[model samples]
Each structure stands twice: as structure tokens, then as C-alpha cells.
Target: MFDELRKALKDWYKVHHRDLPWRHTNHPYAIWLSEIILQQTRVDQGLPYYNRFIERFPSINDLANASEQEVLNLWQGLGYYSRGRNLHATAKCIVDNYQGKFPSTYKELIQLKGIGPYTAAAIASFAYNLPHAVVDGNVYRVLSRYFGIELAINSSEGERLFKTLAQDLLDEAQPALHNQAIMEFGALQCKPVSPNCSLCPVVATCVALREDKIAQLPHKVKKIKTKQRFFVYHLVRNAKNQLAFTKRKPKDIWEGLFEFPLLEFKSEAEQITFLKDKVQVGAAYKHILTHQKITAYFIIDNFPAAADTEVIYLDLADLEYHPIPRLIDKFLNAHRHQIFSVGQ
Candidate 1:
């Protein structure tokens, strides 16, 4: 059954696989960039980032020499800022220790920053044709449904089972082609929602298809409750046409980014009195992520030229230099008139 499924997948992939840029190159640096950029990001969204990264850092040495801020700037709109930091750190390690060459072995790749088992396997197979199984979200979904596996993907048992199965089914003769075929089949055919089973090459052999339970086969444990957060941003402007912004530290989300001074509130109604005492409210916006919802309040303050201030101030002209969050970008667009208005 495994051999039949593999042959079907490979045949279909030969005619229908996507012509992604990374597929054309066997360079480890390019493959690593694609893998990192594609993490938690769609191919359409990640493509531009991948192109930009390759254009900027054509070589591992180039990435190693680049500053953290520059790398973060290129990765600004892409969330998961830690991935960029990790990529930079890993590049530096490669340059310093490996003489600007990516480690060829899967074990050595895993030891590098941000290169986990999945990433290391992907690089090894795709770049070097090494015998390593690449198991990612798409692979898990595809395999679980195809085999009617009941293990929770988040469980330790599930991880072990899938890894063993993936390794067992991998085509040792053509590791790169086999890895790409499985991943591409998963992404394009055995999708998370409304998979095109009718057109799938291996649908006849799929256990979930035979049982008419595609969606329910790959079960996961109950999801954790997402936390709610509130942010009050003081958009204070002084006589010199300067705005208030501060850099987020390394530990927080959007690290190394800049934003208006923020005061977090536990709830919406609780912040009214706090804002009333500090500054006048201008606008409010809500930004949602996978695990957090941020209710942001935008406050504007115009003070006398002589009023002493304690907030970090930056000239409006320098706003481009700072890394503001998308929520703050929306707020700025909504209140552009007041910010650009002629008044001390």
C-alpha cells in the first residue's frame, strides 16, 4: 500500500506540482530562507519575502554580516519576528564556524539555530538528496487521513508514529523528489479544508476517503483558550512636530519594533477613567492574532511648548525609521488629519 501510494503521488507530482522558486535551486542557503519564511506564512505571502531576502542576502556571509535591525526591517510586516532573529543568528554561526557554508549533514543542521528536525530534514533532502523524512503540518494532515491514524498530532505518541511512518515510506533512491512530492500532494490535494479528493491520485487508497471521514480523521486535542489584551497608545505630539514611540524589547512580540507608548488594560471599560486622566482619546482599533486579541486605544495630546514631558519623542519625519505595528499603522491612517494638522 505504501509503495502504491508513493508511485501515485510521484506520478501526479510530475505533472501538477507548483513551480516555486526554491524548487529550481539546490542551494542550502536558498532552501533555508524559503523554509524559514514559509513558517506560519502562506506561499503567496512568503514569496515576496523570500525574493527580498535572497536579493538582500544572496550569500550566507551577506546575511551573517547584516545587522539585526536591518534583518528585522526586511522582516517587519512578517510576524514571528523571532524567526528573523534566529535566521540571522544561524547565518552568523554558519559563516564563523562553517566558513560561510551550510552544514551538509542533517545532525549538524539540527544543531544550528532555528533548524529543527523538520527543517533539517527538509534541507537535507531538498538540497543534498539525503535520506531524511520531512514531516510538517501538511504531511501530518495528509498521512493521518490517508492511513486513518487516530493519534492526536500534538501528542508525543503521534509524533513518534508519524516520524517512523514517514521515514519508512520515504524513497531513499530519490529523497528530494519524494519529499517534494509528498509535501506538494499534501498542500495541493489533501488540504486542511475541503480537500479535492476526487482529483487526488491516491484517493482510492485513502482510508479516510473509503470511510467518508476525511475531516474527522486527523483529530487534535482541545485548543487552549486565547487570552485577551488591551492597549492604550498615547499618540502625543509636541511643538516640534515630534511623535512619541518606543522600541519593544527582545522578549516581547514585535521585538525591536517601535510603537507609541502603550498602557495595557485588563478590560475595555476599565480603561476609560485611566485615559480621561492621562490624555484625550482619539480613535480605537482591534487587532486579532491566533492566540490574542488586542483592543487598542489611540490617544492624542497637544501640550504647550514649555510643558515638561517624560515620553520618548521622535520627529514625525523619522517615523519611517521606526518599526510600528500594523495596528498602529491603521490608527495613523485613520487619524492622519489630526497628526498632520497645523497646530502647536
Candidate 2:
């Protein structure tokens, strides 16, 4: 059954796979860049970023020599910024450690920082044609539905099961082609919701389709609990109206990105009374991340700039030059006048 499914998927993929740029080359650097950019991102959304990275850093040496800020500058609008940071770190590691050569096997690739089991398998199989199966969110959905496996996809046991199954079904004679086929099949045909079952190549062997359990087969036991945080950004400006900016500290969201001087409070009512009386207040802004819901308000302080030791002022013209988060960019775009307004 698995053999037939594999053949059907491969044949279907040969004719149906999207003409992605990264698929054109066996270059490991390009493959790694594409995989990293595609993490937590859809193909349509990640395609442009892949092109940008390739255009800017054509090779491992090029990426290794570039500054982190430059890489992040290119990755400005894309969310999950830590991937951009890791991409730079790994490039430098490859240059310094391996003399600009990417690892040829999954075991060696996995040893690199930020390269996990799934990513390592992808690089090895896709780039080097190693006999390793790459199982990610898409694979989890495809396997659970096709095999009628009623296990939580995020669980340790479930992960091991699906990985073993993916490897068993892989055609070792053509590992790269088979890996790409399965991944593309899951992405285009057996999607997470409302998949095109009528056009599915493996529909005859799909258990969930036959059993009418497509929606519930791929169960996830854990539910993410989002934290609600309230932030007060000090929109301070000197007499010259240069906006105050500061780089975020380590071990937090947007770690390396720049932001305004921030004061976190328990609630919206916990505003600083004296500061409120001194400066004009802006409207509250909401920013959402993977597991956080932030309710933020701007403190438009002008007369006296922030007295904080870490605060550094940026000219209103230079605000866009720094690698700030998308939320900050969004605020700046809407409140350009407020940021440029003359302070009394």
C-alpha cells in the first residue's frame, strides 16, 4: 500500500510541483536558505524572501561576510525574526568551521546550531540525495490522514512514529525526488483543511478519506496558552525631535530588533501619572505574536527626553534604517506626523 502511494505521489508531483527557484539547483546553501525562510511561512509568502536572500547572498561565503543587520534589513517584513538571526549564525559557522562547505549528511547537518531533525533531513536529502526522510507539519498531516493514525501529531511518540513511517516509505534510489514529492503532495493536495480529495492521487488508499475522519485524524493534544501583556512605549523626542530608540535585550521576543523605550505595566490604568500629565498620549495599539497578545500605548513625551541610560535617539529620518519589528513599523507608518511633530 505504501509503495503504491509513494509511486502515485511521485508521478503526481513530477507534473504538478510548483516551479520554485530553489528547486532548480543542488546547491546546499540555496536549499538551506529556502528551507529556513519557508519555516512557519507559506510558499507564496516565502518565495520572495528566498529570492531576496539568494540575490543578496549568492553563496555561503557571501552570507558569512555580511553583517547581521544587513541580513535582517532584507528580512524586515517577514515575521519570526529569530530565523533570520539563525540563518546568519549558521552561515558564519559553515564558513569558519567547514571552510564554507555544508555538511553532506543528516547527522552532521543536525549538529549545526538551529538545525533540527526535520531541517537536517531536508538539507541532506534535498541537497546531497541522502536516504533521509523530511517530516514536518505537512508530513504529519499527510501521514495521519492517509494511514488513519489517531495520534497527536505534536506528541513525542507520534513524532517518532511518523518519522519512522516516512523513512520506510521513502524511495532510497531517489531520496531527493521522493522527499520533494511527499512534501509537495501534503502542501498542495492533502492540506490541513478542505483538501481537494477529488483530485488526490492517493485517495484510493487514504484511510481518513474512506473512514470520513479527515478533519479529526491529525490530532494535537497541546493547546497554546497566549500571554496578554500591556506595554507603554515612551515616544520621546529631544528638542530636535529625534525619536528615542533602543535595541531589545536578549531572551525576549524581537531580541536583536530595535524599539522605543518601553515601560511594561499590569493594566492600561497603571499609566505613569506624572509622565501622562507632561506629554501627549497616543492611542493604544495591539500587536499579536505566536503566543503573546500585546496591548500597547505610546507616551508622546517631548519637553524632556527619556532619562534612561540605554535610550539612544534616532532622527525621524533614520528610524526606518534600523531593524525594528513589524509592529513598530506599523505604528510608525500610521503615526509619522506624530513622530515628526515639533516638541514644545
Candidate 3:
């Protein structure tokens, strides 16, 4: 079964695998950066970031030596900032303990900060051609559907089941190519929505296709209810053309990144007038996250030069020095007129 899957997958991958930037290199540092950036990010969206990271760091030592703020700044628009933090921590570990060399074995790799089982497997196989299973979202989806498994992907049982299956299916002869081929097959062909079954090379042997249960085969745990959040952003600018921004602390969304002064309300029924007393109101917008819809109200305020002592000030000319969330970036763009108008 593994041999049949491998042959079909290898044939398909020869012509269909994406020419990703990370795929062009075997350097563990580069592979690690790509994997970190690609977490919770689409391949197309993650590519430029991957290039930027490689250009910025160039090596594990470079990344390890850089400040956390600098690392977060580079990872600004890419959400899930913990990945960046973990990447930085792992780089430091590699440089300090491993003498700037990424660990070759999956055991040593997993011991490094931020290198989880899947990431370790990816690095092990992709970098060292080590025989290890890479059980990512794509692989889970493909395997669950192909095997007609109904386990909820979020469950521990599902994790063990798929990990076993992935290992069983791995081709020891060319672990790197085989692992990449299966992952790529799932990403491009056995997609979550509207899969291109007609062009799928493995369709002939796909159990889901034979049973006519493509969509229903890979059962998922029901989504948890998302709580709504109301955020009032005080986009205060003073006479010096400086804007107010605050760095979010760790454990918060957009951690280590700057945004306008935020006042979070439990519900939308909170009075805007009450909010106005806290910060001068100027503009407002709503932004949604995977688990929350944040109704963000932007407030612009002008203050006397002496009164600007409280807010963190970014010189209008040097706003780029600070790393801000994309939502804040959008708000600044939308209210540029209001900010510029005040100083004029």
C-alpha cells in the first residue's frame, strides 16, 4: 500500500509540486524559517515573508543575535506572533548549544525551542532526508479522507492515528521527496474545499472517492463559539505630529506589536459618549479574527505639547520604526487626513 501510494505520489509530484522558495534549498535554517512563517499562513502570503526572513537573518546566528522586537517587527503582518518568538528562541538555542548548527535528528530537533513534532519531522526529512513522518493539516486531511477515517482532527486519538499512518506510508528510500510529495499532493489536490479530484493522481485508489464521501470522510471537531470583542482605539496625535501607540504584551493577540491605545468593552452596547471621555473620537472600523469580531472604534485627539507625556509617541516621519498590527496600519491609512489636519 505504501509503495503504491509513493509511486503514484512521486509521479504526480514530478509534474505538479509547487516551486516554493523553501523547496529550492536544503539549509535547515532556511527550512526552519519557511516552516515557521508558513504556520497558519497561506503559501502565497508566506513566500515574501520567507524571503524577507532569509534576507534579514541569513543564518541561525544572525537570527539568534537579533532583538525580539526586531524579529517581531519583521513578522508584523504575519499573525500568530508566538511562532516568531519561538523561532527566535530556537535560533538562540541552536547557536548557543548546537554551535549554530540545526540538530539533524528528530529527537534533538524537538528538544530545541519551538520545534514541535511536526516541525521536527519536517526539518529532519527535508533537511537531512531522515525517515520521519510529517503530519500537518494537509496530510491529516488527505489521510483521513483516503482512509475513510472519521476521527476528529483535534482529538488526541486522531493525532496518534494519523501519525501512525503517516509513518507507515513514508518511503524510507527518499524520505524527503516522499514526505514533501504527500504534503504537496494534499495541499494542491486533496484540498479542503472543491478538491480537483479529476486531476488527482491518487483518485483511482482514494477510498473517499470510491465511497463517494470526500467531504464527509475527514470529520472535524465542532468549532467553539467565538466571543465578540469591542475595542475603542485612541488614535491620539499631539502637536509634535506624534501618534499614540502601545506594544501588546505577551499572551495577548498581536503580542509585541504596537497598536493604538485600546479600551476593550465586553459588549457593543457600551456608550460611545463614555468612550469619548476616555479618548477623543475620530474614526472607527471593525476587524474580525478567526474566533472574534472586534468592533474597533478609532479616536483621534489633539493635545498640547506638554500634555503628550502619557502616550508613546512616534514621530510622524518615523512611524515605521515601531511594529504595528495590520489593523492599526489600515486605521492610520484611513485616518491620515485627520492626523495630518490636526498639526497643520
Candidate 4:
């Protein structure tokens, strides 16, 4: 059954695979970089960033030598800034410990910062053609539906079972192509909602289709609880018409990103109380992260330099050089005309 499935997947992939840049390269650095950027990110969205990184860094040594801010600046608006930081850190680690050589084995790749099991497996198989199977969300969905497994994917038992099944089903002789086939099958054919079951190569043997459980198979045990956060950002302008900005500190969201002076509130009532005396600049902005829902208000303020030494003032024209959170960027883009004056 696994052999037939593998053959069907390979045939389908040969006809249907997208012409992505990553697929054309066997270079471990390129593969590793693409994997990191694509984590929790879609291919279309991550592709440009991949191209940008390659153009900028081009090599592990270049990436390792580049400043953290440079990497973060390029990674701005991608969200999940830690991935950017980790990408930089891991590159340095590989260069420092391995003397700029990309690790070729799964074991070595996994030890690097931010390189988890899935990423390690990907680089190993895709770069070295190692026998390790890549079991990501796509693999989970494909396996669960085809096998009609009802176990929650987030559970330990389900993880082990699916991973084992994927390994057993892998075409070890062509691990790279096999891994790519299964992932692409899940992404394009066996999609989460309204899958193209009609064209699915394995549709004849798909257990979920026969059992009428395509939507329900591949369950997850954990329910994400989104935390609510309220932010009031002060767009403080000094006498020079320069804006005062603060870099978000570490151990928090938007770390290393710049934002207007911020005051966070515990509740909407608290936010309302704080806003009563202050005037707002624009409509409130709502930003959502995987685990946090934020409602932010921006307000205008005129002041000399504040007591906080961390505050850096920059002209509106010069603001383009700084990296900021998406929310802040949205506010600035919307209010750019209103905020800026005629050339002085």
C-alpha cells in the first residue's frame, strides 16, 4: 500500500509541483535558509524574503558577519521576529563551530539554534538526500486523511504514530523528491478546507474520503487562547519636528523593533481612563498574533527630549531607515501625509 501511494504521489508531483527557487538548489545553506523562513509562513509570502536574504547575505559567512539589526530590518513586517534573530544566531553558530560549513546530517542540523526536528529533517534530506522523512503540518494532514487516523496531531502518541508512519512510507531512495511530493500533495491536493479530492492521486485509497472524515481527521489536542492587550502609542515630536521612538526591549513581542512611546493597559477600561486626557491621532488599529490580540491607539505629543535615555529622535524622512512593527508601520503609512509638512 505504501509503495503504491509513493508511486502515485511521485507521479502527481511530477505533473503538479510549483517551480520554486528552493527546489532547484542542493546547497545546504539555501535549503536551510528557505526552511527557516517558511516556518509558520506560506511559500508565496516567504519567497521574496528568501530571495532578499540570498541577495543580501548570499553565504553563511556573510550572514554570520552581518549585524543583527541588518537581518531584522530585512525581516521587518514578517512578524515572528525571533525567527529572524535565530536565523542570524544559527548562521554565526555554524560558521564559528563548523568553520562556515553547512551541516550535512540531521543530527548536526538539529543542534543548531532554531533548527528543530522538521527543519533538520528537511535540510538533511533536501540537501544531503539523507533518509530522514520530513513530517510537517502537510505530512500530518496527508497521512491522517489517507490513513483515516483520528488521533489528535498535537498529542504525543499521535505525533509518534504519524512520524513513524511517514518514515515507513518514505521513498528512501529519493527522500528529497518524496518529502517534497508528500508536502506539496498536502498543500495543493489535500488542503485543509475544500481539498481537491477529485484530482488527488491517492483519492482511490484515501481512508478519510471513504470514511467521510476529511475535515475531522488530523485533529489537534490543544486550543489556542489569545491574550488581549491594549496599547497607547505616543507619537512624541520634539521642537525639531523629529519623532521620539523607543526600541522594544527583549523578552517581549516586537523585540528590537522601534515604536512610538508606548503605555500598555490591562483592560479596555484602563485604556479608556488613560486616553481621557489625551487626544488620539488616528483610528484605533487592531493587530493579531498567534496568541495575542492587540488594540492599539496612537496619539500625538509635542515635547523636548524625555528623561529616558533610550529615546532616539529621527526626522520623518529618516524614519524609513528604522525597523518598526507592522502595526506601527500601518499607522505611519496611513498618516504620513497628515504627519509630514511641506519641505522646509
Candidate 5:
């Protein structure tokens, strides 16, 4: 069953796979860049970012030498800012420790900061043709549905089971092709929602389709608990036409990014009470993270408080030079006329 499934997937991939830039090269750096950029990001969205990064940085050494802010700026629209930071850090580490060459083996690749087991396996197989199975979300879904496995993917037992099954099904002689085929198959054909099962090469043998459990397979034991956060941003413009902005500190969201002076409230009531008297600058912005739902409001401070050392005043024109969260960007864009009118 595994052998036939493998052949069917590889055959399907040969005729139907999308022609992505990363697939054209076996260079570890390019492959690694694509994988990282595509994490939690769609192929269409991440493609431009991958191209921009490759064009701007060109090499691992070039990326290593670039500033963290520069990396973050390029990565502004793409959430999960930590991945940007880690990408920069890992580039530097590679240059300093590995002499700008990517570690060839999975063991060495996994030791890098941002490279997890899935990423390491992807790099190993896709770049070096090493026989390491890639077991990501796509793989888990495909495997669970194909084999009718009932184990929760997030559980340790399920992880081991899936990993072993994936490895067993892998075509050792053509690991790169097999890995790419299975992942692409999962992404394009056997999708999480409304899979193209009718056209799938292994549709005849798919257990999920046979048992009507396509949506129920690949079960997760844990559900993410989302936290509600409320923020009030003070858009204080001084007499010099400069707005007060501060860099976010570490161990928090948007760390190292710049934004207006912020005050966080524990509840919506507290946030509403504080903003009741103040005039809102723009429509309230709601930004959703993996584990947090943040609703933020921006208000103009006519008589601003004494400036703190951490707060830096920047001309409206200079705001582009600083990295800010998308929520702040949305506010600025929405109320550009009002902000500029006040400044003038």
C-alpha cells in the first residue's frame, strides 16, 4: 500500500506541481529561505517575499550583515516577527560558525535556531537528497487521512507514529522528489478543507474518502486559548511637527518595532472608560495573533506629557524609515489626511 501510494503521489506531482522558484534550485540557502518564508504563509503571499529577500540579500553572508531592523522592515506585513529575527540571527550564526555554508546533515541543521525538525528534514531532502522524511502539518493531514490513523497529531505518540510511517513510505532512492511530491500533494490535492479528492491520484485508496472522515482525521488534542488585549496609542505630535514614538521592548509582541506611546488595559471596559473623553484619531484596529486578539485605539494628545528618554520624535516623513506593526500602519493610512492636516 505504501509503495503504490508513493508511486501514485510522485507520478501526480510530476504532471501537476506548481513551478515555484525554490523548486528550480537545490541550493540549501534558497530552499531554507523559501521554507521559512512559507511557514504559516500562503504560497502566493510568500513568493514575493522570497524573491525580495533573495534579490536584496543574495547570499547568506549578505543577509547576516544586514541589520535586524532592516530584516524586520522587509518582514513587516508578514506576521510572526520572531521568524524574521531568527532568520537574521541564524544567517549570522551560519556565517560566523559554518563559514557561510549551510550544514549538510539533518543533525547539524536542526541545531540552528530557527530550523526545527520539519525545516531540517526539508532542507536535508530538498537540497542534499538526503533520506529524511518531512512531517509538517500537510504531511500529518495527508498521512492521517490516507492511512485512516485516529491518533491526535499533536500528541507524542501520534508524532512518533506519523514520523515512522512517513519515513517508511519515503522513496529512499529519490528522497527529494518523494518529499516534494507528498508535501505538494497535501497542499494542492489533499487539502485541509474541500480537498480535490476526485482528481487525486490515490483517491481510490484514500481511507478518509472511503470512511467519510476527511474533516475528522488529523485530530489535534489541544485547542489554542486566545487572550484578549486592549491598547491605547497616544499620537502625540510636538510643536516641531514630530510625533512621539517608542521602540517596543523585548519579551512582548512587536518587539524591536516602533509605535506610538502605548498603554495596555486588562479589559474592554477599562479601555473604553479611558478613551470615553478622548477623541479617537481613526477607526479602532483589531489585529489577530495566534494566541491573542488585540483591539487598539489611537488618540491625539494635544497637551502631551513630558517626553521620556525612550520616546523619540520623528517627522511624519521619517515614519517610513522605522518598522511599525501593521495595526499602526493601518491607523496611519486611514487617517493620513487628518494627521497631515494637524501637522500642517
Candidate 6:
């Protein structure tokens, strides 16, 4: 049974696999970079970033030696900036501890910072051809619908069951090809929406097809409630024509990325009251994340001197070099008139 299923899937893959840049490489560093970038990111969007990153930092040592701001700048538009941070940190770890070589086995790969189970499995199989099943969203969808799994995927038991089933179906002789085939089959063929069930090779064996449970088979325990956040950014410029910026602390969405000095308020009234000095407020900007929705308002200010705080100020001409969030980039582009209207 396993051989039949594997043959069907691998045969489909051999003819239908997308010519992605990551798929052509057996280099562990390149594969690891691609996996990290693709998390919470689409392949179309992540592919260019992958190309740019590898081109700039071809080797792990190059990534480790580069500044965090350089990495974040390259990853500015990509929402999940933490991946960039971790990519750099892990590269440094490899260079410092592992002599710039990615861990060769599943156990060692999983032990590295920011390398989760899915990533570990992918690298292990693709780079080393180790017999570990990749259990990403694509795999979950494919296995759940084909196997008629009714357990909530968010639950531990469900995860265990699906992972076990995925492992059971893995073709150990061709783990790399098998892993790629399963993930691609799910992404292109058995998609979340209306899939091309007419061309499905395993439709006869797929329980969800016979029972019309494709949408319901991969059950989730709960729907996530995105947290709301309000941000007040003070875009300060001094007589020297330098704009101030600060680093986001850990545990935040844009952790280790640069942004203007920010203050959080529970409400608009509270934010207005907290403003010791009246400043020109720009239109509100909204930047949505997977688990958080950010409403950011910019306050434009000017002075003859600096605030004497820890804020690092850069010339307006040099703003392009510093890494800022997409929200800030949008705000700056929309209100460039205010910035250029004044001079030192």
C-alpha cells in the first residue's frame, strides 16, 4: 500500500514539481535559509528575498559577519522580521560553534536556535536525505484529507497521529523526493480551496473525497483572536537634520528591527493626554500581523537640539540604509512633504 501511494505521489512530482531555486540545491545552508524565509511567507514573495539573501551572504560565515541592521534592511518588507534575526543569529552560532557547517542530523538541527521541528525535518531530508517526515501545513492538509483524520490539528494527539502517519508513508529509499512530492502535492493539487480533484491521483483512496470532508477533515481546535495594539511614533529631527530611530526589544513582532521612538497607549484619548507637547499628527497607518493588528500614528516634531537620550539619529539622506518596518516606510513615503518642507 505504501509503495503504491509513494509511487503515485513521486510520479506526480517528477512531472509537476515547481522549479524553485531552493529545490535545486543540496547545500544545507541554502536549504535552511529557504525554509526559514518561507515560514508565514508565500513562495512567490519569499523567492526573491531568498535570492537576494544568498547572493549577499552566500556562505554562513558571510551572514554571521554582516550586521543585524544589514540583514533587517534586506528583509524590511517581509513582515516576519524575527526570521531574519534568527537567521543571522543561527548563522553566527554555526560559524562560532559548528565551524560554519549546518548540523548534519535531525537531532543536531533541531537543537539550533530558531530551527523548529518542521525546519529540522526538511533540512535533514533534503540536505542529508535522512528519513524524517516533513510535517508542515501542506503535509498536514494532504495527510488529513487523504486519511480522513477528524482530530483537531491543534491538539497534541492529532499532531502525533498525523506525524506518525506521515512517517509511516515516507519512502525511506527516496526520502528527499518523497518529502518534496508530498508537500508540493498538497500545495498545488489538494489545496485549501477548490482543488483540481479531477486530476488527483490518489482520489480513489482519499477518504475525504468519497465522504465530502476535505474542508472538515483537518479540524482546528480554536480560531486565533488577534490582539490589538496602538503605537504612537515620534518622528524627531534636530537642527543637524538627523532622524532618530530605536531598536525593538525581544518578544515583539519586529524584534531586533529598527523603528522610530514609540509610545503605546490604550486609547486615542490617553495618547492625546500623554502628549506633553502638541505635535502634528499624521494619518493613522494599519499594519496587520498573523496574531496582532497594529494601528500606528506618527507625530512629527522639530527642535534646535537633541533630546540627549539613547536615540540614534541619521541624516534624511541616509534613511535608506537603516532597516525600518513596512509601516514606517509607508508613513514616510505618504508624508514626505512634511519631511522635505523643512531644512536645518
Compared with the true structure, the alpha-carbon lDDT of candidate 6 equals 0.86
- What are the Cα lDDT values of the candidates? 0.85, 0.85, 0.82, 0.89, 0.91, 0.86
Best candidate per lDDT, number? 5
What tens digits encode model 4's per-residue C-alpha lDDT throughout 1-344?
A: 89999999999999999999999999999999999999999999999999999999999999999999999999987889999999999999988999999988888889988999999999999999999999999999999999999999888899899999999999999999999999999899899999998877777899999989988978888777899999988777667988888888899999998888888889999998878857677788999998999999987654334466388888877767888999988898888666544232
| Model 2 RMSD vs true structure | 16.3
Return the TM-score for candidate 1, rounded to 2 decimals.
Answer: 0.65
lDDT of 2 by residue, 214-305 (tens): 99979999778998888877787676767778888889999978888887777656754434664544577889999999987776653243
Task: Quote model 2's TM-score.
Answer: 0.65
What TM-score do all the candidates reach, one by one?
0.65, 0.65, 0.64, 0.66, 0.65, 0.65
lDDT of 5 by residue, 1-344 (tens): 98899899899999999999999999999999999999999999999999999999999999999999999999989999999999999999999999999999999999998899999999999999999999988899999999999999988999999999999999999999999999999998888999998888888899999999999988988877999999998888777878888898889999999998888899999999999878677777899998999999888764344464388899878977999998888888788678757532
- Root-mean-square deviation per candidate: 16.4, 16.3, 16.9, 17.2, 16.9, 17.1
Better of 3 and 5 by lDDT: 5
lDDT of 4 at 76: 89
Which pairs clash (backbone N, Cα, C closer than 3 Å) in model 1?
A: none
Q: After superposition, how far is residue 40 of candidate 4 from its true place, in Å?
A: 1.1
Q: Name model 6 segments beyond 4 Å from true.
A: 223-344
- Residues forming the 10-long window of minimal summed lDDT in candidate 5: 300-309
Predicted candidate 3 versus true structure: per-residue lDDT over 1-344, tens digit per residue: 66788898888899999998889989898998998888889999999999998898899899999999999999999998999899999898888888998888998988877778999999999999999989988898889888778888888988788899899999999999998998998898888888999987777788888998887857888877887788877667666767777778788689888877766777777836546454443555777888877778765544332333345878755667778888877876766776666432
